[model samples]
Target: MTSATLHGYLEQSARRSPGTCAAVEASSGRQITYGEIDRLSSRVGDHLRRIGVRPADRVGICLPKSIASLAVLFGILKVGAAYVPVDSLAPPARNAFIFNDCGVRAIFVEASRAENLRYELARLAAEPRLLPLDWSDASSPLATYLARVEPEGGLTVEDESARPGPDSLAYVLYTSGSTGQPKGVMLTHRNGSSYVDWCSEILAPDESDRFSSHAPFHFDLSILDIFVPLKHGATVFLIGEELGKNPTRMASVIAERRLTIWYSTPSVLTLLVEHGSLDARDDHALRFILFAGEVFPVKHLRRLKAVVPRARYLNLYGPTETNVCTYYEIPQTIAEDRSAPFPIGRACSHVKARVIDANGRDVPRGQEGQLAISGAPVMLGYWNMPERTSAAFHVNSSGRWYRTGDVVIEDGDGVYTFRGRRDRMVKRRGYRIELGEIETALYRHPAISEVAAIARSEEAGVSIKVFYASRDGHALSLIDLKRFCAHNLPAYMAPDWFSHQQLLPKTSTDKIDYQHLMRME
Candidate 1:
């Protein structure tokens, strides 16, 4: 009777609307209905089970966005196995580390990326079975491979009684670790289903809604884009890699396809507003514009709002360890207030968040302290790192809490606003400076298109350096930036060195590559 797992919702929706379209490829004009998804995923699931994929086993998926990829994702879950999404665009060494760390039973990859996988797999001690799914250039089709593993008509439903419980692992998302390697965050069926259930209640997507899947599967934000739509029998319109990189084209696709739900990082939305010609689109049916991953610059957000005119904006905040613990509805009243960053808002219906001081005690309203969260959305903990997991969580009178490294301020109204990372706070010139505050101020400037702030050690002491991308091809000199900073920021906060780059480097997840930027200067 209970539908607390992600696959449970998928099966429920499929039974409710079998003929409804579940996914569409924008570039190819191809669409797959829920009935088709149920069948194909069943087929894939049979294939996986025949190849020794059992309940609680770990599988890795490193394919691009497509109907095949979605089928594999559900198929892994259908067999009660947890999947690890490997970033196809990441370096081979990084992928190898994830493979060795998780000890995945098998990897579902595309033939196009076979060479890359082979290179990474060579370095690993444990050899996982490679199930390549690309048959574009092959003489045969995927059915040929399926027949090898599964017997005729073996795609029938598995034993429903064997379905994983809420506590069973559903997926493992790897995030950039402080030690430079990636750490896998283990999430159970209950953890992911809790987030999906919360989203279903708040931002419900009916069959009429066409959700845009902009973020890659490797990114946690893509969870809402993928699962939320599938649960409601809505269509998921995949934005290709080329279009995701070009915001202007992405806007055109949104208008052309009449995508109803838009979810992506604030940086991607900012790019769309500045260069995506969103205002020129005539048929942009976007009703909900959900942004997260990083803070949105107010200036860029205002411009985007003008273009959509009627869309509702929601700021979603959470780390990979906790998926969307807090959300803030952007009220029109705050459009005029630009002095402080937007609030991360209150916790979701199923999440509990509190601001705690350094001593692990709760802080009074309006005081800056570390943000902590507990509840259904929290992860099971870091994979295979008990010491690190123990250090990350703290038990108090209320409940066990996962300590978020982020520092936030909670107003008397219970709204939480992000300050900066606790580690990012540095002392320079006998004054404490937050690098994020500097980056936020620099974003307000007209000339700087994108910026990243870092603290560098110098002979005199520590100095601030900013690597910025210019909007006008380096028209603004370092003196011009210095003068602007002098007017807007404190003496210690202003960067002593300004490095100009054509574009800010980005990680595979599309976040600013601050680590790489720090090495530039």
Candidate 2:
């Protein structure tokens, strides 16, 4: 059972603990044991092979968080292919762009979603084959496909062959691109294996522990949420998208499911503190509270710590390209002092990180600079984007480093603190959104002559505000623009507030003064 690939971890775990719970649906109370997951995923691998899914090919997975999604993920990996997860809540156009951009020839979806994607599939120049897993009708494609395939116990010509190696691509997660398109971040098994290996050492999970899966599959944080638990034979309690938005319900589900490990953005913690009624509540099952994606407000962190005083809190920091390169263990003193932002701590065991100045040399202690990470976990690069990939990384005498567009200040103690972003990307509610992407979507509207989007801190988290100019004599309303954005972008990327302006503020050089707009907020 010794294997190097990501899927092999699951196979090893299943062999070690066949009867242990692998995942559970919080809403439906449905559970999938490790034994069933392995057998079912093997069947999925066989099915995918019959459909000609080749090793190194990309396969799209658009199902919601459930036992089926987990199976489909491992199944895709079992066949030596990577799964491209598109958020089912996102607009079809966005998903279509991802599907085409990644050149995915096949997709696994729910039956209802398959019906909705009929038109989107037709729109694509090279339509991908559909495998709707939720459909139960005997005439359905999934049923028909399964009927032709032999049982798991039966021998398969394709099953005897070797699975993908550690260096092979495991998944391609698409993130908001600055040019109105989404860029797929290509990560290999080596990348994920390093992360999971590091996680096992830091956050120890056993068969008695239960994990809370709050992040969507598209987000990198989900890697730890799904794989770490599976690797250790623990149960993963899935929090659906709807429940995740309602912090009160999410808190209730956590207590009910007895989730021992909680991981999400600070915004979610803020929501739980303000709305979920977590203060003064003693839910001792939550042992590890891991927050990433954004800096948690000191006040909110203080309040959360007061409620879950015994729980160990860790602030994880990194971009999707490198899944949590650094982590800070929030000491209890932070609940009182609250003088500085939590340090991003040192690099993980598998990574080497440095703060470099504009000239690429290491920045002096206590000075601000961009973070450059070099490690096995660093992504392969943006898929099919050689120029951009080359531009994003730098080579030094030591090794190759991925230049994270994030700026930070490193202390003499080697602790890094968050400064700001070098680019237009903003983290809100665990989702990384590019302001330029929103502006580009707005610019496509016929009535919008000019547009600029900015993120402002709100009560719960960050809010997006868009300032737009209308075409001559064409009056624009917030309602209309909201509707337009809803049609094109995901809900998280949509503007929370809109302002119509005849002329946006500009710098002396005639460039849009984003700082002025941010101050106006």
Candidate 3:
């Protein structure tokens, strides 16, 4: 049977291979099979229905990455309610904003974090029913909570009238807004399933494949990590927050568990290559390594290729508004001294990409312009912000297209290389400067582990400031660093200030926190 909704993937997998492992916890060595996932999630859905969570209602999930969380997610979908996942590590106020913004009727959270979240929601005059996954009492555990809900007969029926359709809202992902608060990007079942179908076709993993779920559930990267495996009856290993930050532990998990397909940001992969000690371990089981969210420095990618030569490397590109619209597969061999970052590649099979100038006209190949995406994977719109949503897209005779807000150049070969963000370009002393270009050049240096270039407004003009972390904890001489930058970059593009730290602050998704860097003295 063809599954119309995202949860239907799990139902299909369970029916085909009920005993096959669906998910495994790296820290606890716990595993859950497809049959169990189906049954458990059905119970969750039944409970939601009992609690008056009707179709199209929003349900909040504020727990850590675990089998239970995955079950809760599917259960919410099973009952035709959209799930709103907040970063468990984020402050209660931020989570409260998301809950209130989406108007979630109930929240499933861990006991330890529930009180603060409840308090914050109350202060906002928003009261969502709180269901703790684990109780504080000595006798109650997660199982105890599940025991309270009676399981339905089985997975929800395939009748279109009884469940959500492909166009129904599946989840609401909150991303950093230009304003102080975060805004929700609403994605429907069709939006998710289209990307999942494309990936399943491209990767073609069988039941034996093991996928690494490294990204947090709230992040868009987790969409592929969690669903692609489920669609093909493969196992997904959940990497916890603490373990995700530890390079050594991450390396061990990959090699020990034999994770077949690994997906994460280049920053995390860079850490693994620099400190994971990959050369010493036998990681022959890995078949595909995928990265997205940020550009992968060519130099660092070269090092990773040397260690895991057998695996196919792919660079997936997109924002939360368009989930993985384009991808570039690294060639078998790159020049040993390649310094330029690789292109984000062509659009995905299900998506169409266009480069348009400021005047809304299509730019010629080799000309820089803003990238626009229109396809199955394109999001429905921003939640409840019609004006913002209207401004985000450009409607014409062809169709409505979401403006990616990313600048790129299309080559003769039909590949799109990321230039920089539209807003990241700064005019300094009559010359336009791209901060990402400076950061790209600095990444070529062997001593620099991670770097970010910021544009600052000073009395004289807009000056560029560079913040970097060295491979070794010790700081490098400013003279030498400046000399290196001078040799690689034009005089007008050189930075005015440099700051060195043992490590740059990272956001919950593991990307460098530029906002935090800007706030630092």
Which stretches in model 3 have alpha-carbon errors above 4 Å?
Answer: 135-141, 149-162
Expressed as tens digits, the lDDT of each residue in 1-521 for candidate 1 is: 23778888778888999999999877677788898888888788887777778889999988777777788888899889998998877776788789779989998877777777777778776588888876575433354556565654433446677778899999999998867878999999899888988998888678899999988888899888888998888999987667788987888888989999999988899888878888888667899999999888787888788788788999999999998999999975544558466889988998999889777899888889999999998999999999989888888888889999999999888889999988789998689888999988888887778888988888989988888888876756767898889999988787888888888888777788878977785
Model 1 ranges with Cα > 4 A deviation:
138-162, 333-339
| Candidate 3 clash pair list | none
Error of 2 at 318 (Å): 0.8
Q: List per-prediction Cα lDDT, in the order shown.
A: 0.84, 0.81, 0.90
Predicted candidate 2 versus true structure: per-residue lDDT over 290-331, tens digit per residue: 988865656667768888888899999889899899999998
Error of 2 at 421 (Å): 0.2
lDDT of 3 at 446: 80
Q: How does model 1 fare in lDDT? A: 0.84
Q: For residues 92-197, could you state the per-residue lDDT of candidate 3 as single tens digits?
A: 9999999999999999998899999999999999999998877466232455687855453333334456579899999999999757678999999999999999
Q: Which candidate should be chosen as best, given TM-score against the real structure?
A: 3
By summed lDDT, the worst window of 10 consecutive residues in model 1 runs over 137-146
Stretches of candidate 2 off by over 4 Å are 1-3, 135-156, 159-162, 335-339, 424-521
